[model samples]
Target: MFLKSYTGADDARIYHNEGDCVVRYVKEQCNRHPTNWPVEPGTIVAAYAAHTRQTLYLEQKDFCNKNHPLGLGKPGKQPQRSVILPMLTPNNRVLAIMEFDKDETGFKEEKIHYALAYGSWVTAALIRKGIRESLRDAKEYNATILNCLKCFLHEKLTLNQCISAIMITMREFIRAEKVIFYHIIADKKLDADIYEATSYNRDIFTKVSRKIDLRKDFLMKDVAENHVVVNIHKGDEEQDFKKYNITDPAINSVLCVPIGNPKRLLGIVKVINKVDHPMFFDIDLVNVSNAGMYCTSIIFYTAIGKQLDNTITIANKQKVTLTRHMIPCIHDIIQFRSRPITKPPPYYLSFDWYPTKDELSRDLLADYVWWMFNDLFEGDVFMEKFDVFVLMCKKGYRKTSSYHNFEHAFCATHCMFVIVRTCSQKFSYLEQMALMCAMLCHDIDHPGNTNPFLKASEHPLSKLYKFAFLENHHSNVTRILINHCKIFDHLAPDDYKAMVDDMHRLIVATDLAKHFRKKKYLDDLVKDKRFDDSLPAHKMHLKSIIMTTCDLSGQFKPFDRTREITFSLYIELYKEGDWLKSKGLPVHSTLDRTRYLDIPQDQVNFLSMVVIPCVQLLVQMVPVLKDPYTLSCNNLDIWKRVSFSKLFH
Candidate 1:
C-alpha cells in the first residue's frame, strides 16, 4: 500500500499495488449499471472511471475547505492532524511530498517565510522605481527653470522687465509669498522700490519706508557688506527676529540676498516665506539671488546709456549754435579787412601813413570788432584796441570796393589781430591800435594775387619798389594811401614810423617763401629761452613768427572747414601753375609740379612731424607761453591728421 497527500487535491489517498507498480479501484459508475466490483478481472473501465470521478470531486472540496483561498480559515476551525506521505503518479510511481493540517504550526511558519520573501522583492523594486522617478522630476524642474532664465536674458530686457518676468515665473514655480527689490543710491541709502506680494497687501512700499533704516540699520548692513544671502527661519535662536519686527502674521521668515557687481554692493532682495512650505532655506535664497544679479547689471547699463544720450544731445546743440553765430562773424571780419592799397594819398607821405574810412562805418566796425576781441582776449585791453584798428581797415576796404569781394581783406585783418593779440602785451592801446591799422591797410586792394603778378604787370608801385621784399612794398602802398588821405592827419610822426616798422614785419611774414626762414628764427629764440625778459629783439622775433604762423594757421582749424579752405587754395594754386606753364615761364619752386597742388596734405603731415614738436619745445623753453602754445600745438596736430586723412584718403 502507498499513501499520498497533495495540496492541489487536498485528499489523502491510499493506493494498493497489484503488480508492476500499478493501482486499481473498485467502484460503481453513475451512468452504468450499479456494480461494486469488476466482473472482468483484466479491466473494469466503467467502475474505474466512476472511482476516479468520485476522487476528483472529493479532492476539490477538501482543497477549498482546507486551503481557504479567501483567507478565512481560523486556527481553531481547521484540522490539526494529517498523514505525511509520498504522492503516487497515475502509474503508481512514488514522488516525495509533505502533508500536514491546514493550521499546523510548522506549515504556517513555512507559509509566512515564503510570503515575506516575495514581499521583500516587490518592495525593493517599488523603492527603486520611486527613486528614479524623483531624480527625473528634479532634472525636469531644473531644466524648465534654466530655460525660463535663458529666454529672459536673451530679450535684453530692462531691470524692471527682467524683475517682473522673474517674479511671474518664480510665483508659478517657486510659489513665494512676497518678493522685494532694493537699490542703493550714491548716498548709500537703500529703498525697497520693487515689490511683488502675492498673498499680502502690496502697499508695503508706502507703509514700509518709515520702518526701514537701510543705511545704518544693523540687519541690512550685514547682508550688504558680506554680499551673502541670509535665510531666516521661524524659531531660529541664532538671530533676534523681534528687532526686525518679524512676527507670525507679518513676515515670519525671510530670505535676504544682496544684489551687487563684483566690486560693490548694489542693494538687496528679500523673499518672504514659501506659499506651501512653512520654512525657507539658504538654497532658496541663493536661487533668487542668482537671478537678481542679472537684473542689477541691466539696471546699471540702462542708467549709463541714458547719461551718454543726454551728454551727446547737449553737445550737439552747442555745436549748432556755435556754427550759426560765431563762425559767420569770424568769417566776415577776415574777408573785409586785410588788403593792399592801390592808390596813393597826399597827407600821409611825409610821415608814416594810416588809412581811414567813414566815421560811422568805422565806429560800427570797431564796436563789432571790440565785442569779438573782448570775448577772445578776455582780460587784455591792448589786444581789443588793436582789433578795433583792424576792423577800421576792413570797414574802409568794404566802402572802397562797394562791399564786393571783401572776404580776403577781412580774413587778413582777422589774422593780423590774432597775431598781435597772441604775441605781446607791451604796446600801449593807441600804439597797438595804430600798428593793427597799418597791418590791415598794408595789404588792401591785394587783387587776390601775389607779388609776382605785380612784378609781371610792372605796376607803378612795383617799379618804384623794384626787388623790395613783398611785405615792404605792401607797407609802402599802405603809407602812400594814408598820406594822400586827410582822414589820418590826427596821428603823430614818430608814433606812425614805429607802427609802420611793426606792420612791415607782420606783412612780410605772410609770404610763403619766407616760412622756413621765419620758422628757423622762431626756433632759435625758443632754443635760447629768449622770451623770458620780453627784450626788444625777442619781442620783435616773437611778433614776426606769430604773424607768419597765423597766416598759415587755417590748416589748424576744424577738419571739415579746413578742407573747404584747402580746396579753395588748390583752385587758386592750380590756376597760377597753369598760367606759368602757358607762358613758357619757369614756375616758382613751390608750384613747380602739379603734384605739389596737394600742399595742404603735405603741410598737415609736416605740422605733425615738425610744427607740433617745435611748438612743444617752445612751451618747455618759455613757461609763460606754455598753456596757449601747448593748446595751439594740440589743435594743430588733431586737425592736421583728421583733415588729411578725411580729404586725401
Candidate 2:
C-alpha cells in the first residue's frame, strides 16, 4: 500500500538489502496494489541489481525460450522483459530495488529514465514514512511494556503471570521463537519459572523447565555471576545446546541475558532463535536486556517488599557502557578489488611525509593499503583475505573520534611500514606482519578518552581491563576482526599461534602508561650493550620500543601537521577532562581543559620525555630510524618556541 504503481506491466516486485542478502519487501500482481510480502534472498534480477547497485534490463526474445535468464532461473512466471532499478540513499546505501516487467513490450529508454527519477522521490518518501512508523511503533511498544510493569507493581498479576506476559511481548517484538525465564535457587540451581514459545517448539518447552545445576553449568554460572550476556548467532548451536541440555533442532541462534543487579542474584532470560532474521543483532540483544531489567525489578519487589530503583539505575548505566564496547556489526563486507593508485611522492616513506586529504581519502586509502599489503606479503591465502581484513580494520575504527580515528590508524600504519621496509632483513616476516597489524588496529574503537578518565568515571571497560585498558580493548577488537575475517586461516598452526602472540604483545606495547618502564628497559639493554636480536627477551624489548616509536610518529610529522594532530588529541582529552570535572572525579592536569594555556609546554615535555626517548632508543637499535628521531627533536624545539596564544591561533 505504501508504493502503488501501474507501469503497464504484468507484475512488479520491490527488494530491500538486509545484512548480506536481498529480501523481497513487496510484491505485485497484474498491476494491482503491492502487498508487503517478505521473501528470502534468491538469485533474481532484483537481487542482482541490489548486489551490484546497478540497473539491469533482461529481455526475453522468445516467450518459450528455455535458456536460463542471466544464468539465474528461479521457479516463477517468466516475463517477456523486465528491468530492475536500485533505489539508493544519499550515501549510495542501497535502500531497495524496483523491478518492472512487461508481458508485451519492453521498457523504452525514456521509461527507464523516468523510473529512475521517480525512484529518488520514492526513496525519500519511504524513508520519511519509515521514520514516522518506527517512532509510532516504539511509543506503542514502550507503553505495552509500561503497562505490564504497572500490572506487576500494583499486585494485579502474579510473578509468573507478569513475567510471562512481558516475555510474550518481548518475543513478539523481537520475533524470536521462544523466551525462557529461569529463577536461581540459592546460587546452586537454575529452575525454569516461565517458558513462552511462539511456534515450532511448543513441545520442547515442557521439557525446557528442568533444573540446571549452576555449579556444573559453567556457561550459565558465568552469566549469572558476571552478568555477561551470551549471544550466539550461528555455528555453535549444538555446543550451546549441550551446555543448556536442550535438543531443539529449530534453535539456530540464541541470546541469553542475566536478570539482576550487581548486588544480588535473580534470574536469567533466554531469547532463542529469531524467526525470520538469520542472526540476532545488537538491537535484539538490547531489547531483551532491557526487558530483563524490568523482570529483575518485578521479581525483587515481589520477594524483598521494596523497589530496586538505585540498583536498577546502576545496572542500566553498566549495560550502556557494555553495549558501547560491544563489537560493531560489519554492514558492508563487499570484497575490495585492488585498483591502481597514483604512486606516492618520492618522500612517501619519509617521517615528514604527510598525505594530502585527496591522497588519503577512504577509497585511496583502501588502494594504498592493498598496494602496500601486496608489496609486503606474497602468501596467496593472505593476499586473498587481505582485502576483507583491511575493510574490517577500517570499519572497526570509530570515525567520530577527533584524534584516534581511521586516519590516525592509517598514518601510524604507514609509519610502521616505513620501519618494516627499512628493517625487512632484521625482523622476521611474521614479526613485520604483527607490527603492521598492531599499528593498524592499535587505537580501534577508541572512545577518545584516557585510561585515568575511564577508571575515575567507573566505566565498564575499566572493570574489564585494570591496566593497559584501551590498548587491551583495541587489541581484543583487532583479534575479533582478524578471526572474523579469517585473515590467517591458511597459516601453519605454529606460525598462526606465533603471529597472534606477537601481535598481542606488540599491540599492548602501545600503551603510553607503560612507556616509561619499557623505555627504561630498552635503554638499559642498549646502554649495557646487551641488546641482541637472537635473544627472545631482547628482541621483544626492541619490538616494544619500536611500537612506541610508531605510535608517537605523529609527533615527528611536519611542524604544522604535528600541531594539528596534537590539537585534535587535546580536543578529545580535554573533553574527557571536562566530563570528569563535572562528575567530581580526579582529572589529570594534561587532560584538564582549564589548563589549555599550558598545552604547548606539556607537548614539549611529553616529546622530550616520552617521544624523543623512545625514538632515540629505536634509532640506536636501528640507525635508519634517525629520520623520525631528528624530526621528533625538531618538533620539540618548535613546540618549545611557540607561545600558547599564537599556538592556538
Candidate 3:
C-alpha cells in the first residue's frame, strides 16, 4: 500500500491508498483542527520514515487500540507486521513512502529488499515529474520578467501605466493577493499605492495615500536603513505582524523588498499575502530583488528627465547653451605641441622615481604617458588620438588644488605603467590601455576636498551625487573628456564597451572606503590559492588592487619624497578643515591643524593598516611587486621611529 506524506494548509497527513485512509497531525501550526483524527500506527511509521529517510518495521504487537485502515486495530484478518520504506531522490530528498503489510505468513527479509528495490523506480519517476514542472515554472517566470522590462521601456507608456503594468505582472507571477508600491516621496515621507490583480486582465486600485512617514513606520524604516528584504510568515505570524506593525488579521505573510543601494533609497515593493505557498521562498526573493533593480533605474532616469527639462528652461532664459565651452582657439593660443615620445628613465618605473621642476615646466610628463601606452599597445590602438586624449585630461585637472592635481595623476599613471610592464602576461592589450587611461583621468577636476566635507558643507557636488561624490564626478568628467577627444572611436562597439566598463571600475576602486573589504576578498582568493588569471572576476580583483596600490605609490617612495607628498595631502585637508571651522562645523582630528603633532603616528597607523597589507597581497599574487612591498615595510619603520622621537621633542 502507498502512504504519501502530504503537507496541508494547517496540518500534515499520511494518506494510505491515495486518501482511502489518512492520519492527520498539526504541522508547524499551534491551533488544533476541528476534526482531530487519531494518529494510527501505519501513519506514524510512514511519517517517521519520510522524515528520517529511513525504513521502519512495525510488528502487530506495536499496534495500539487506535483505528487503522489495514484492520490491525480490530485484529480480524489483520497484518502481523508492516515495513515502511522511504522513497527518496538521488540527493536524499523525500518523495514518498511505501508500506507493506503481511499476515501470519509474515514478510521474509528478502521480500523487504524487493520492496525497497521497487521504491527506487517511483522515486525516479517523481524526480522526472518535478524537473518538468520546475522547467515550466522557470520559463513562465522569465517571460513575466521580460514583459515587465518591456513595459518599463515602452516610450509611449505613462509613468502610471508602467507602474501598473509591473504590479500586475508581479502579482500574477508571485500569486500575491496584492502588491503595494511605496514610492519614497521625500527624505521622511512615502506615497503608498495599492493594486490588486484579482483577474489577470484587470487591476483594481484599492487605495492611494501619500501621508505615510518613514520615521514612524518601523517596517519601512528597517528596510530603508538596512537595505534588507523582510519576509514574514506562519508559526511566528502573530509576533512578526505585531513587531512590523501589521494590524490586519487577514494578511498572514508579507515580502518587503528595498529598491536601491545603501547610499540611496529609491522606493520599496511590498508583496502581501503569498497565495500559493506558506511563505515567500527563495525564488520569490530573487524575482523581487531583480524587479527592485529595474525600478531603481526607471526612477533615476525619470528624475533625470525632469531635471534636464528644468535645466533647459534656465539656459533658455539666460540666453546661453547648457554645455560648458572653452575659449575658441585656446589650443592654438597655448601652442601645445606633441613631441616624439621615448621610453621613460629607469627610475621612473621604481618607487624612488620623482620628476624635477624642469620636467613639469617643459610639459614632458605627458610624453611619458604617451610612451607607456604606445609601448603597451605596440602602437596599434590610440596612436594618433592618445596625445589629444592625454592633453584633454590634463586640461580637465583644476589648477587650484595643492595635491590631487595633474602632477598627482601623472605620478599614479607612471606607477601603473610599471605594474603592467612587469606583469605583462597577466593583462591583455586593451586591459593595459584601460589601466593607464583610468590612472590618467582618475583625479581629473579635483576640488582638493574629501567626500565627507563636500556632504557636510552641502557643496553643489553633494546635490548632484548622493554618495561617492568625488569619484562619480571624476568618472563623469573622464567620460566627457574621452568623448571630446574621441580617443576610443577606432575600436569596435563591443571592445569599446568593455574598455569603458573596465575604466570606470578601475577609477572607482580608488575610493579608500572600499579598500578593506576588497583586500579581505583578495586575501581569501590568495589564501585558498584559487586565483586563476583566466577568470575575468579574478583578473578584475587583481586590477582593482593594482589601482589602489598605484594610487598610494607615494607612500612607498623614498623617505623624502614620501614626506613631501604626505605634507601636500595634509595641507589640502587642513585647508578644508579651516573652512569648516570658519563655518562653525566640526573637523576630523586628522584634518584639524591643531592635531598636526599626530601626523607621524597617523602615518604609521595608515601604513600598517592600508598600504603594507595591500602591496603584500599584490606581491603574493605577482612576485614582481616585492620592491614596492619592501619599500612599504621600510616606510612603516621610519614612521614608527619618527613617532617615537616626537615624544622627546
Question: What local lDDT score does residue 206 receive in model 1, on the 0 to 100 scale?
Answer: 19
- Name the lDDT of candidate 1: 0.48
Candidate 2 colliding pairs, count: 0
The full ranking of all candidates by lDDT, starting with the best, is 2, 3, 1
lDDT of 3 by residue, 271-385 (tens): 8777644467666777776665565566667888999999979856533321133112456324545334645676676666867767778777767877777777755757776
Query: Model 1: per-residue lDDT, tens digit, 1-649?
Result: 1111223222232333221222333245644322132211233222232223121211213433322232111123434333233333333222212233333332344443443343345445644664587467546645655664566558655345555665555444445677776655534545434445434544222112332456455557667766656676666543556665455566666778887753577767777766534456444665676656655655566677788899789867854553233222555556534532123233322111123445234434344344434444466534523443444345434333322223434333455464445544655655455445554564554444456856765666576664444556556555544443323455577765666566666666556556555566666666675654357766565555444444444444444544555565555555666777887877763454567644655656656765455445444544444433554465566554553345665
Global local distance difference test of model 3: 0.72
Which is the better candidate, 1 or 3, if ranked by TM-score? 3
lDDT of each: 0.48, 0.73, 0.72
Instruction: List model 2 lDDT by residue over 50-77, tens digit each.
Output: 6557777777653222222232222366
Number of colliding residue pairs in each model: 23, 0, 0
- The alpha-carbon lDDT assigned to residue 440 of candidate 3 equals 88
Candidate 2: residue 252 Cα off by (Å): 58
- RMSD in angstroms between candidate 3 and the native structure over all alpha carbons: 16.5
